[model samples]
Structures are given as C-alpha cells and as structure tokens.
Target: MASNGSDPHGPDRPVVGLTTYGERAAYGVWDHDTVLLPSTYPDIVFAAGGIPVLLPPRPQAAAAVDRIDALVLSGGPDIDPQRYGADRHPLTGAARAERDAAEIAMLQRALEREIPVLGVCRGLQMLNVALGGTLVQHLPDAVGHNGHNPTPGKFATTMVDLVPGGRVATAVGTTVAVQCHHHQALDRLADGLVVTARAGDGTVEAVELDERPFVVGVQWHPEQDATDIRLMAALLAATRT
Candidate 1:
C-alpha cells in the first residue's frame, strides 16, 4: 500500500501505528475510563523520530494496516491459550479477547503488506501465537525461575545475549541489559521466523523475520529505558526505505 496522499507524515517522516491496550484505566480525579496505551510507548516512538498514532481496540483499524509505515504491537494481558490450541495453565491470567482479535488481525495484515513491526513483551507472544506457535503458559514451570517478571508490576533488568549476526545484534549489540516484566515466553518458534536472542536461562528473548525488512520481537520491554532506544530507532529507520 502506498503512503496515504492526504496523510500529514508525507514522505519525510513515516507515521508509525502503535497498538494500544483497551481497558478501564483511572487517572487524576477520573475514576475509570477506556484508555489507549501507556504513555511510555508513544513517547519512545516520538523520541525515535516516528509520528506515533495510538491504535485502540477497534477491529476496523486492522484493515488499514497497510496505510501506516510501521506497526508496534504493545505489551498487555495474556493471550488466550485457545489461540494456539492449548488448554489454559492454572497460572495463566485473564485473557483479553478484544485486544487479541484486533492485534492478531493487524499483525497478519501488516505482515502481508510488508510493514515494519516491533513486538515487545506480550507482543512477542502475540506474534508467535498469530503464526501458529505455542507459548509456555506458565514460564516458571518451564524456565524454573520468575526473573522475567519478578514483581507483579515492576520492571526487572535481564541480561540478554543476542544471536551472532542477527538483526537484534545489528540493532542493539551482541548483548544488552533489558527492562522486562512478563511471566510467559515462547515455547515453539514459528515457521518463517528465527530466534535472534535468548536469556541466560535459555528463554527465547528475541526473534526476526528471516527475509523481511525489520519485523522483530523481543520478550523484554525496550520502551522502558534509554539503552533500548536503538531497537526502536532501527524500526523507524526501516520505514523510510
């Protein structure tokens, strides 16, 4: 899909569509209301030089995926285990069906249109499940540790070693200290994607398309710190070409 002629981004700057989580959120005096995403996401995109647009849980948006230059699958609630033909683990959290439907559709359409994509945290799991892969529902049972999301609502620093000559290595470096908070991970890789990085515990940390422009997914939250900016910047760079 060619760039929208009436769009403001024009040819100089590409508009990056970042998927947002829709849930009851509270702020200031407002008790609760539906919100798009955590401000950190769009902030990082802006700092990376892309015009960030918050894509809420509207299934219609998925059909226009080709109109954007790139797509950022944001982190959120656990994907339904049924998505990958598995029963839910006892520790699996509540699933977000609306978000699941919208994001999966957008991911598929974005891939079909060759749009650059960056999947973070739960986003990584979504990418895998969308491509007919399964997830380690209760990671601690398989990885033997909860370091991925040590705290319920806090970030943990994890040392991730990148696969040599992979896209992640080319974007960040051979190894990186990442900010992460998740309790699940990939168990089986998809057909067209390859593992690009891993944690010390052998958890799959990152993956990239074998032949695409800049489709990549990381189990960590890169938007949480400055050190991971290069990864986001790499996605922005891919939009121009």
Candidate 2:
C-alpha cells in the first residue's frame, strides 16, 4: 500500500482526489476567478477515512490521478451539449469548458487504471456523457415537475430505490432517501454502465459500471448528508482491492 505521508490513519489510508469548481468569486478583498469547492466534499471524504485532494480544472489536472487511490467527480454546472452531440437547452446552464475537459480526462484515466470513482449530481451526468451516454438537458421537461430541483441553493429530499443485489444496494441499501439538486439526468445510458437506482418519478438517480472495482454515480448529493458516509466509504473500501 502507498503511504500517505503525515496521514493520522497511518500510511495505509487511501488518498482520494476530488474535482472542484473553477469560477469567479470574491474572497478577502480579492474578486477574481478562483478554484473552489464546498467544504462538505472534503469533509465527507475525511469522514470516509481518505485524505482529500482537491483537483482544479486545468490542462494537466488529470495527471494527479497517478498520486491518488480514488477519485470523486464533484457536482458542478451543466456539461457542454456539444460534447454529446446535442444543442444547448434554454434552461441548461452555460458550460464550463475547462472543467468538462479536465474531469473527462481524469475520469478516463481513472477508469483505465481501474481506480474507485464516485460521481455526484453533475458528476453523475458527466460519467454518463463521458462514456457515450446522453442527458435529458432539462429534467423538468421530461419528468413534468421540478421536484428534483425545487429550489435554488438548497437540496431537496427525494426517495430512490436501488436495484436488488447491485453494488449501490450493497452500499446504501435497496431504498434510501437522498438530497437532490439537479436539473439534468441521464437519457441514454452508455455501454458497460447499468442503472442501479431511480427516483419515484422514474428519473435516473444512480448508475454504476459493474465491471470496474467501484464506479458509482449518484444524482443526489451524499456529501450534503453528514450522517451518511456509506457511498464515500464504499469508494474508500474499493481502493484497498
């Protein structure tokens, strides 16, 4: 096992890399572009027994995978429609081109290396799009309601049922209530990936590539729930194998 220098859990504790958002912000008299993420992400990773490394969107960010044992594609803005051969939707947020490129590259490298990966919200959509899948663009248009994202800046609670005997089920059980805040979802699932969970409204909520050690994507934000570390814990556990 690779030693995580200075990690309190000793050298065997896995190192987990998380993707962050690149956007304009103001901090301490500085108002400019910055790379940042909600503390919840790192907090959950730490609670899961992994050292968190925040990866900014950059040309060489994917290379960081070589130093980490697992990867977490954190939630962010909508992906560029062109990446999946579609026109932009009016409701779809503008694409973060650099973030899209960086995360896709990292995901590719992680999958090739067969490292554990967890995708949240936009991360889930990215997993699908990166692997030849398509998104619904505007989820409300397809689901007939904005229940998935009923408010801005706040996560809504929703119920999802996992497929029996699936990896997701094993980690979080067959039925679970999750925090959701997404306006897009998987439309055409990619090859080698299977739908492992869905919302009561029939919207896809989770997916996984069973062939890999651990490649799970959840439309909800598990990080937001300080109590449930099962998903992240599962990713950390996969790093051991």
Candidate 3:
C-alpha cells in the first residue's frame, strides 16, 4: 500500500531539490542580496507528495545531488549566452553568471546519477544549453512577435501539442493549455533530447532525454496553475523508483 505522506510512520516522501535565484530582494525594511524562489514551485511539489528543498546558487551546489531524490531547475533570469558560444542579443536580459554556473553543475551531476529532473521556463533553457543545445535568444526576432511573452509580469496562455507516447503525453495527454512567460526558446536541440511538445506558433514547448528514466523540460510554468499538477506529480512518481 502506498503511504499518504501525511503520517509520520508512513514511508518517507522523496526529497525534491529546487534551484533558486540569487538576486537582490526586498522583504520588509531589509533590502539585500538573497536566495529566493517563488512559493508556487515548492507548493506544487508538496501537493504532489514530495519534500521540497531549496537549493541556492553556490560554488558547491552540485554536491546537493548526493542528498536529493529528484531535482527541479526552477525558472529565473536568462543564462549567459557565452556559455553556449553566442554573442549577447540586444533584447536579451542580463545573465546571472553565478546562478548559471551553479545550476549547470547541479544539473550535470543529477544527470550522472540518473536523478529525475523537471525544468520550468528558464529552467528548460538551462537544460538545453547544458546539453550542447542552443537557444533562439529572442523569440520575437525569430518568431516575429512577442506572443510567448505578450505582457510583462504576467503569464500568456499557450496551447501545446504533445508527441504521442512520450513522457509528457503520458502525464498530460496529447494537448494542454499552459502558462508561458519566456522570451527565448530552444534552437539547436541537444544530441539526445526528443522534442515532446510544441506550441501553435511552432515554438519548442518541451523536450526530454528518453535514455534516462525521467528528464523532462517544459518551456511553460506548470507551477503557476495551482489546479493542475500532473507535471510535478509525474516527477515525484519517478523518484519512487
């Protein structure tokens, strides 16, 4: 029988380590540099019957894989283009070098250990770049519009078509409406990643490394929609094995 995760005597839940943002933040009268992440990320994880652990960017963040059952590369700032051998685009936002280095190390370590991983938004981009993939840098320039990020500080609605029999399809079916807020997307796909989903505008919406038990990256913010948790739930399920 599966434990409900609420009872102390029940089987222990999987520990999910989520990467966070290293930025200057304000809370009350204190305005200083801090490690932060949206509560929605952890909220959805806990709802899916997993223990959530925040992983801040640090020199040795990759060591965290030794203590976690799964990893989530949460959404945040743009990755430095130089990491992938590209010149910065005029429209590209400033990169968080430290965060990029730390997350990449953590991701590589997680992959080496075959730890289940789920990437969201910028997290998706990181997965691609870390695996020798490249990003469009500016979707508006490539797609000729900003529909993927129609508004600032708000999510745009996007309908994605999932490839049949893929991990994403098994979790969320063939078609799904997702919340999107990204200005960049996957360009030259990595060597082993399979395209699992795409937007109506022909944007790459998701990718996965089929060789691994679970390594999925979605260009949408699944955590934003509190009502739906299929993605996070699927990630937690992988941790059990």
Candidate 4:
C-alpha cells in the first residue's frame, strides 16, 4: 500500500518532518533503494504527541515543509568541510554532499517560515555550518579525551549545564544527563544562535536561536536516552501554539 504520507491524527498533533539517510541500506535480507532513519527519532516525536514523517534527503523534498508544523534534522553523516570554508581535518569523516545540500535547503526554509527545528549531533553541526559556523572536526584532539564519545559505536554519558532561563533550561532544567556519541563539535557558533549549554569540558552541548522560540540544537543524542524527551516535547509544544 502506498502512503500519501498523510496522517489521520495530524490535525491536533502537529506534523514534524524528519530527515533520513538516502543510501543503500540492508536489513533482514532486504536490499534496495531506501531512505532510513533510526526509530528513536519518530518514536520520541510520537511520545511527545507529534506525528512524525520521514523526509527523504532531496532538495525537492524541502517543499514538503509547507505541510508540516516543524522539522527535525536527524543525526547522520558528516558535512562537507568546504561548506564552512575549511580544509579537511586529518580525522574528518567522509562527507555526504547530497544530504548536506538537502537538509541545508530545507533548514533554510524552516527557519524562514519560523518553523520549530531540533537538530541532534551531525544535524547540529550542519546547522552551524549552514549559518557560517565552523567545526572542531576531531573532538579528542580538541578536548584531550574521548569521553564525549568513549566508544566508536556506542553512547556515552556527559553532564551538560544549561543557561539560566534559556530554551533548553526552561524545557529540561539547568542540568541533564545526556547521551552522546560524536567526534565533531561546534567551533565558532553561527550568527543568530546562542549557546545555551555546555559540557563539563566546555564543549558546546546545546544551542537555541536568539530570536526564535523553538529553534534548538543539541550535541547529545537525547532520543537514545529514552528518559528525557524534553527537547522533543518543547518542539511539539511550540507547534501547538
């Protein structure tokens, strides 16, 4: 059955556009053209009382934002270093030009429309780059430890302190236990973004737009925690108003 991508419960429950990976994905002996996202994304959105729609990473897909109330640029591949006018770091991961172009286009639309957006990990990095920010590229080199992402393919714990009365502070309070798994971080924050939280070692853990109510990004992977959905809840609540 082909889905028109509409949800019956979408009226009261604002629709959120979630970006996905456009790559060859294999699962359960199946292999084909696919756009896939971690279930944690949609699952948290639903738990926060919003309808989640998987958005394929295509520039044309940016038009679909017209039908949704908010956007969430899910975490994935690294952004092209050239996007930020920097040479590649020795440890920089492979760039995904297609995904980068698609999300940046859609993100510009969402911000112009004043739609709520929550970016996580790579999503956060891309957001920064799109708005003229730079990245650290390699965190362990920048910070002297890999605690932010102790394991290559697993979640690690970190304590983040939120700015007083900031968007993240108001939603999830002053301090939080966050799940993180990344080796890149925001170096020079983009214009219009205010740093709202930081890890113990001064890594930028969270940010919110200086002028927008719901545009926020977090370095940590909140969805993987399962206990804290405040960020998702905040975005959902913003759509209601």
Candidate 5:
C-alpha cells in the first residue's frame, strides 16, 4: 500500500476508489463544473479505516484502475435498461449514457484483474448488468411488493436477512438493518456471483462472488444510516488484501 499520507487508523490503510455521478450545478441557469459525490459515501469508508479516493466519470476507465487498490461503485441514478436488454420504464430517472459506458468498462477491467469491488444500490445493478445479468428496474413491479417504501429517500433505514454462511454474515456476524433509497434491484444475478441477502419481500438485497477477492453488492445504502459499519469495513479490508 502507498504511504503517501499517514493512516488515521495507525496502520497501512487501503486506498479504495469510490465512483460517483456528475451533478450539474443549478446557478442562474449558468453551467458550472461537474460536482463530485454527496460525500456521505466516503465519510463512511473513512470512518471504517480506509482512505476514500473519488473517481470521476471518465472514458479511459481502464487506465484509472491502476491508481487505486480497490473500487467501490456508489449509488446513483437508474441505469439505462437498454444496457441490460430491457425497455425504459416510465418512472426511470435520468440516465447518463457516458457514465454508464465508463462504469461498465471499469467493472469489466476490475473483474478481469481480480480486483476487489463493492457495489451499492445502482452500483449493484451495474455490476449485475456488466456480468451478463438482469435487473428488476422497478422493485414494486418485479418483487410484487413495495421494497423501497420503508426508505423513500436517502438517509432512511430498511431490514435485510443475511444468507447463512454467506460473505455478509461472515463479516457482520448477523443479519441487521441497513440504509436504502433505491427502487430497482437485481432480477437475475450476474455470472459467478451468489445471492447473500434478501428483504422480507424476497427482493435480492445482497450478492457476493464465489471466487476470490472481495466482490459484493448490496441493495441498501450503508453510507446513509451508518448502522451497518461492517459494509464499509469489509470494503476496506478487501482493498488492503
């Protein structure tokens, strides 16, 4: 690990690069520079003993991977269904084509290199689609129940049951509450990834790769409630290894 900066945790801190969506500034209708993530994501990671590196949207995502130890794909807008062979839903939010392409490229590169990756919410969906998987697009429609109701916006809470003997169970030692704010979820898992958790409605809440190197996805947003500290800790631990 690079000791370019002192570790706040008093050890070799892992460098985890977190990807975020670009938000256009709304100032007098004048276009401003692209803004980074909302900051809660990295704050959680930092509190969990890892250094957070923000990766901006880029076309040369392959080259960007060399700069970090591991990758954390953060939550954002609904992914374009076309990328995963589905028609657009009437409620589908904004879709950034460039970001979609870049993130897909980055995910492919990471898996090819066997690098650790953690995906949350939309990030989870991206991982699934990149690995020959499909998504529900709207949880209410697919799950046949309101999976996102408990948490309608950011900074809310939800429940998840950990799959026994799964990666999340091993990390957290128990199924617990996590924060969520997404309307979409995994319909069919990506290749080589196993479902590790679920909601009461039986919505897929988490998944982990059967192979080596920490690659997992969660439907909840741990960055919001900070209840599932293990989520961030696990990512940091993967980055160090």
Candidate 6:
C-alpha cells in the first residue's frame, strides 16, 4: 500500500520496513513475484520484539517513511551493477532499480529522523551503495574465496572475525562463525562507516554506521544464522530510544 504522508500508527510499535525482490514476467507472472523471504526474518524480528513491514519498490517513498520507525533491507538478488559503476557479472541476478531507489530513500529518511536500521545480505550492500560506498562485484572471482554468496537455495557456514570493540563484536559478544551466501562484498567501506567484522580471508563481512543509533549491516545472512541474534536485539533497542 502506498503512503499518504502520515504515520499510520502514531509511534507505537517499532515498524521495520524491509525491501522486497523484483521479478520479471515468467509466463504470466515472474518467479520472483512469488519469491518469499525466509520465515526467519519475521520470526527474528518478532523474537526481537519489532513489527515487520515489507517495503515494496515505490516512487512515493517520502510518504512511506512517515509510517515506519525503523528499516531492515532484506536479502535478495545482486544489487544493480550501475550502482557501483561496474559491468554485470554473468552471475548477477534480477536488478530492481525501483527497489534500490525506494530503499535508499527510506535509508535517507531514517537517518534524517534518526531511525534504527539493520541491513542483511543484499540489504547490507544496499546500505553501502546508498552511502557512497562501492561493492566487489564477484567475491570468489575477485577475492579468491570459495563462495561468499552461496547458491540461493542452500546454506553454508563460515567464520567471521570481528575487530575488538567493533559494533558487531559488542553486539554479538564474540568473533564467531556465521552463515554466509553472497558472492559479492563491500570493496570500499562507506564514508563514516566502519568495518566491524570480516571473513578470515579478509573479505569484509559486516559494517556499521557509527553516528547512527543502530545502522548495522552484515554480509552474512543473520536471519538464517543462529549466532547473529545480537544484531536484531541491538536494532530493536534503538527503536525504543
């Protein structure tokens, strides 16, 4: 539903707007149209005590921000190649230019209003690009890792080390293993953003905006990983403030 420039619920529940994937027509409808986010997303949000709202790609994003308290850019296909000034890799997936614009608008609004945000996987990349950051188009090919982004249908476990006293370490309370499935990663950490975690091989794994109340992003899929519960908890805490 499009917004009419008003807070729909008047600051009660902390509403988190998550970006959705785009789909091209397949037969009558695109397969991505019906693509569902892992149930873990809402489960984890609710577990962390926040309301989850899907943020569809819309041109009227300024109006949408009025109704949300926070934002969570969910994982999906690769971000648009033009965003970071690169050619599309053969493996890049569907790019929703509308979704990219909407999410960035949401991110900007959240920051201006000081709303907490938690970006996961593709969401993380979105946050980086939105903040003038660049991305490594293909991690394994560029950085020599097995597969930073695993096949979309399956899950893989990998280790992520956190810099001592970094946001992710302070939140997770440990430099431990996590589940990763991205083939791309942050090549240049956004200005004012700090690298909080990384793969043992030096692939950037997580980043957080120091000035924002709770703008944290992780390359790994935290919603699917048991070790990253602190990210949700930290974001929820920011909503209360």
- Note each model's CA RMSD in angstroms: 3.0, 2.2, 2.5, 4.0, 2.8, 5.0
Which residue pairs collide in model 5, if any? none
Candidate 6 worst ten-residue window by lDDT = 1-10
Residue 25, candidate 2: Cα error in Å is: 0.4
Winner on TM-score between 1 and 5 is 1
lDDT for each residue of candidate 1 in 8-114, tens digit (9 for 90 to 100) = 33455667888887788777887665856878888887776667888877788896687788999999889999999999898998888888999999998999888
lDDT of 2 by residue, 34-147 (tens): 999999999988887789999999859999998899989999899999999999899889889999999999999999888889999999999999999999999999989999
Report how far off residue 161 is in candidate 1 (Å). Answer: 0.6
TM-score of decoy 4? 0.93
Worst 10 residues of 1 by lDDT: 1-10
Q: How does model 5 fare in lDDT? A: 0.78
Off by over 4 Å in 6: 1-12, 24-36, 150-152, 225-228
Cα lDDT for residue 52, model 1?
81
Order the candidate numbers by TM-score, best to worst: 2, 3, 4, 1, 5, 6
Off by over 4 Å in 3: 1-11
Q: Record all residue pairs in model 2 with backbone atoms less than 3 Å apart, i.e. clashing.
A: none
Better of 2 and 6 by lDDT: 2
Question: Which stretches in model 5 have alpha-carbon errors above 4 Å?
Answer: 2-8, 27-33, 150-152
How accurate locally is residue 143 in candidate 4, as Cα lDDT from 0 to 100?
91
Best by lDDT: 2
Q: Single out the weakest 10-residue window by summed lDDT for candidate 5.
A: 1-10
